[model samples]
Target: MAAKAFQPRHQSVSRGIAFRLVSVGCYSVMAALLKLASEHGVVAGEMLFYRAIFALPVVLVWALRSGGVRALTTRRPWAHLGRCALGIAAILCSFQALIMLPLATATTVGFTAPIFATVLSVLFLGERAGNHHWLAVALGLVGVAIIMLPGGPANDTAPLPGVAVALLAALGTASVVTVVRQLRHSEHVAAIVFWFFASSALVGGILLLYVGKQHDLQTLAILAGAGFAAGIMQITLTESLHATQVSILAPLDYLQIVGALALGWLVFSELPGQSAILGGCLIISSGIYLIWREYRPQTIARRNLEANTV
Candidate 1:
């Protein structure tokens, strides 16, 4: 294993914003196409195989270009395994939610990860949370409830199962974040990425034996695009963080919801109800506040201490 190499922050907020914006687009497209594939009869487990396997070559090429093969080596294999496992579970949940719910609704629910992350820090990192943190978490839950609540018409649709799974996805995502943050201190970005896709593809390949089904050419193309978009999103997302504070970029993430809304309407003929809109607003506000709080000077100091202790 190689020691971590140091690089200075890019310090260009404009470039960071651009990367974040692109990342948001890729993520939106990934989720949208993922849902489209599901409508074509692809299951989440099968899509997970496509998402991981197709992204492997892309990640590998990028890893080689950015650094030699050595950049793919890691000091902590177990951490990478754990992160990959969490990622697979989180993505499966997200895909399941997308299949069961509308695009905008699923995207909005996914944003609740920050709320989960806040609680994770307090519980596992020995960070003391103020009342505001709990308030933010409560707001996030209220938003989810509003989204899941039945409204108007004959009530033919029930989204409770999807919303519940989406919340679990958010928790899985937060746990992955904690492990990845720790890994970044000592592992190269390329290493963290390479092993993730590599290991996930391996696991997904095995699971494919039970869940895999053939797709039409059109559906295969959609899954391939989704995989590429996911890979690009991962790369650009990491670069964005290297350039600026996550708090500054956090608000821009809501742009994905707007994108999701457009895709849901234009592609799937789905429109979010008033409750979904209101709930989305609450979830976004909660996520933004949680991210902002995490970046505060006082909080960052405590976080640093927590990291050191770990």
Candidate 2:
């Protein structure tokens, strides 16, 4: 009887994992598109503008399907605003880092967001972490230290600003996710997606007016591709999370570094040094450990919820 109960849950978890892998692939493609647009002289603001613009229509269509156009309202406008601000800041810093560093290296550093998120959840959400989780977070930091060793980007150049920005972005992302978790049952997924895009587009447009330059037709086309890819990647990411626990799906995000590395090698010939690889491995190991520790219970809960709902 126990085996019968567990078998289907295991299968569901496996399916979620497969979807997450696909989501990671989509994100990799999106990152590559962003890199391509950046090379063509698109500022972070312009890229963001296009991303939000393209995302708005797609997200609205989703919103309409879920509840028509009227389904777009949110009682928590402040939450939406705060999330938009943090997300936009993160995007700008990340894009700037992409401009300066090897894509792979930047992506590896950016993966620190999960560790940050885990920590923030404890403080903000009052979620408790086990000793194993603490150990995982510690190990992740040590990995970051390895990446930021003496004569490294953290110490050698102005890369600290970018890194700091990335860290803040991670914190903001975690906050957004926590908020979403709180609203999971109350808010429709389409509503959440729509608000993010609409608020981001409005705010991004304002920012663009100050910093954006005119783009050539070719450049505009590249930006459009970036936006399209970003929207698709986001949709897949959301779907993956809906289908699984954050603990399971979040770690797969580290794969973005691998994608960035491959793209960097083939397109820009930017090879990461040995230290970066070593540090990245350590970081990834800790993240994987955290996922293993956290996901089991989350999967069980999700399976139970589904069973009860049915």
What are the RMSD figures for all models against the true structure?
A: 2.3, 5.6
Model 2: per-residue lDDT, tens digit, 96-214? 77766667767787777668778877898766788888888998889777776777643433255555555555566666666665555555566667777877788779988898888
Poorly placed runs, candidate 1 (over 4 Å)? 1-8, 151-158, 301-310
lDDT of 1 at 10: 68
Clash tally, candidates in order: 0, 0
| lDDT against true structure, model 1 | 0.84
Give, for candidate 1, the lowest lDDT window spanning 10 residues.
Answer: 150-159
lDDT of predicted model 2: 0.70
Q: Please, what are the lDDT tens digits per residue for candidate 1 over residues 103-222?
A: 888888999998888888778766688999999999999988877777632123327888888888889999988777678887888888888888778777888899888889999999
User: How good is model 2 by TM-score?
Assistant: 0.84
Extract clashing residue pairs from model 2. none
TM-score of 1: 0.93
